[model samples]
Target: MVTATADFVVPDELLAHEPPEARGVPRDAVRMLVSTPSAQRHQLFRDLPTVLRPGDLLVVNTSATLPAAVPTLDGHVIHFSTCRADGTWLVEPRLAGRAGAPTVGPLDTAVAGQRFALRGGGSVTLLSPYSQGRLWVAALSFDDVPGYLSRHGSPIRYSYVPRSWPLSAYQTVFATEPGSAEMPSAGRPFTDRIVTRLVSAGVQVAPIVLHTGVASAEGHERPYPEWFSVPASTARAVASAQRVIAVGTTVVRALETTGGAAGSGWTDLVVTPERGVRVVDGLLTGFHEPHASHLDLLAAVAGPGLVSTSYAAALAAGYRWHEFGDVNLLLSEHDVREV
Candidate 1:
């Protein structure tokens, strides 16, 4: 057996910062390479529905991405940026989160001890701009915090991403609730049109809420604890489905967190071979960094061979990594799912 360690090396060029310009297609359109745990093979994303027979079920996380990055008078600040079960985003930042109240000028002009009145007079004290651009965590009153932000805040955005895309672009077609730091980008390619096609073609879609904090790509600390709820109906639907096609890692995490382990609320359930997985028949996820903790989870589910083959194919084929990049897919050869 090959011992696995979270120690793989990754090339920086593999990272993606923008979505593909094409539309009316499966969000899973990014270069997809299919392989097995023991042997590598080739497959296409469009063949996804065809790969499954009648009893297979498809499970997906629908936790919508929030506009966690907000523009204050100073510039743009980010927050809750907790990563969901998937390696995608649902950025939900608090006004007083790391960045303090924004100043009236550029981030360079803002410094410690500076105070600014928020949209609702919820005053804040500037702490630091270590983030470089325009982010600072400040002290503020708790009054109407969410309300104030909803009114004055635009989604948090980073400069490197270029072209301020709307909050909608960061989500899957089945998005629900506002809990993610950013959208689970692997699901982004799943527009309404694609969902219709998949459903009509005998695919089952289910939704769950795993309020993701931020993108780990931001290079922050381990995800702050986020909440996950699996209603009885959704649980039954997933348990009964023939195949579980997870939209991204978040959905996989949420479903696995529920099966076998009987708990709810904030879960720090990081997936590895030790923990293993009980749910999710297949995965529709973005290419991830080599040796990433998220990679551990995927390898656990897809197995090293399937993961390695698929990922190897993705890399060789130039699939992008991260929320805005293309996607990768994995399916069991044995007929485990029902159509």
Candidate 2:
């Protein structure tokens, strides 16, 4: 039987606990590890413009990170994952044990019909179970969720993060729409200066929207359906570009779900080795956890052999992991050679 790349072991020490800004570095100062079929190259994230050619079109996700974690009076936190068409949301309730402790774990409480009083004025009523466990379909009492979150919610964080960060620290420079439960972190290394340099080098940057859901996953679980949109202009640029470089796995999913055409919908597409990619030529993403389903998408684009080598190289170099971590650029063998 073939093994999945998701079974790899990532060292806990490599998990980045703070943003670069906290470490006294600029947004684009993170390390970038470029991977190809034949070789790997270590470079700074600021070197992106010099690395790619003029005709390469970079596709980015514009969905902003939401301050989706609402604390309750009882010490439990409610995470707003995704908002459904009916105005209700899919949420997960977690017990925040204490400071410097795990914030989310197995939730054993029954939520149906239970009303949670948030720190803010409004309340959340649990409607029903959205899945097997941990998640529920719930309604918000407030009329405007965005405005409420701005005033009361904090960025969703786990134990690894140790402390909370402002929502502005979670947002990318390209973020324009507010929806993602987590940051589109691949774009975290980008800055206005970096973008200007890329444009000066003739690299075209385009936006696609993929309102990402929660990042926490059950062991070996496949990706859940998330809303995505590929506009006509982005589709055209992707079709005409010499190379279509996706900024994250979200971009890969959105572009591939439409088969490079213009469309919008919820997609449960899993880009595995068996179900190889069709549109994206390369990917720029952060280092993910070992055994993460995201690794399957990387394998589908760069092949499992190269993915393994790249992971090994990244670990050997003590590269950081998580949303505020280092980045990986997966391009073709020829593209790497050209750089």
Candidate 3:
């Protein structure tokens, strides 16, 4: 089963440069595109609880977003992607902007064993290149890693974001563990009101932890191993669920890594068309970049045809894209849908 390919021209205007709040709208006010095997429709995100039926379970990622980008005095920033059990971190160095945003670049001047001072009295020593010369294995020296980072580090930003936003804007309502480098953006549309509506509608919300790595990668690059945890209770809930709806790609990857068991570990599970998902009956996720490896995971759930059609409809409807963008709910046609 080869991965399906499609061409999409995302207009520059469709890019979500800031949160919905900045645009004078609530978080749940974003649009949602619902795609099944036979049909597709557009709806508001706040209507999700009404759309899903009773006994359905929504699996969410509780891994919190980290202010991982640490700027240095030398005009460079170190992005903390993932941490190893041995206390080493997988990091990337990029050119620092005047306003604290990062422009992706190679650390051409970085050498193993070289130490550089950070802006807020910490230091990082390069150990070696990790993958394709874009990431590094570095050791950090700080009194309190979390505290120091809170004072100095900023959320990782890409060129699509016009300016820097607060770290709170990158977080979701379900975020609990502070480990992920980037937001589990699919869950961002859920608000307290949405959660209440879901519970009142008899939908169960389960949480799993997957500390995400850097998301800004070249088109062909696959995701690296990231730390994940699936508790026994969540696994049991998944087993008994009438429909298991994964809230994000991170949740799908973490649940699949469990293999019907429950524990914590690192996973490099790249969901593709050939390697279809087993534990998820559906998925609620945000719009992704074209030709990105994430599109393969979406293809696995919705199939290539539905994936392509849904994206076209979303684009035509003026939906936003990226972390702060609109959402897509891909479900099986045979499920017991309500709306």
**Model 2: CA > 4 A from native:** 1-4, 99-102, 337-339
lDDT, model 1, position 117: 48
lDDT of 3 by residue, 259-321 (tens): 646889889888887888888889999988877788888888778877888888888899899
> Which model, 1 or 3, shows the larger lDDT?
3
Query: lDDT of all predictions, in order shown?
Result: 0.59, 0.85, 0.85
TM-score of 1: 0.73
TM-score, every prediction: 0.73, 0.94, 0.94
- Residue range 94-154, candidate 2, lDDT tens digits: 8876854547664658569988899967788899987667778888888688788889888
RMSD of each: 6.6, 2.0, 1.9
Order the candidates by TM-score, highest first: 3, 2, 1
**RMSD score of candidate 2 (Å):** 2.0
- State the lDDT at 52 in candidate 2: 90
Clashing residue pairs in candidate 3 are none
Model 1, C-alpha of 145: deviation from truth (Å): 5.3
- Model 1 scores worst on lDDT over the 10 consecutive residues at 88-97
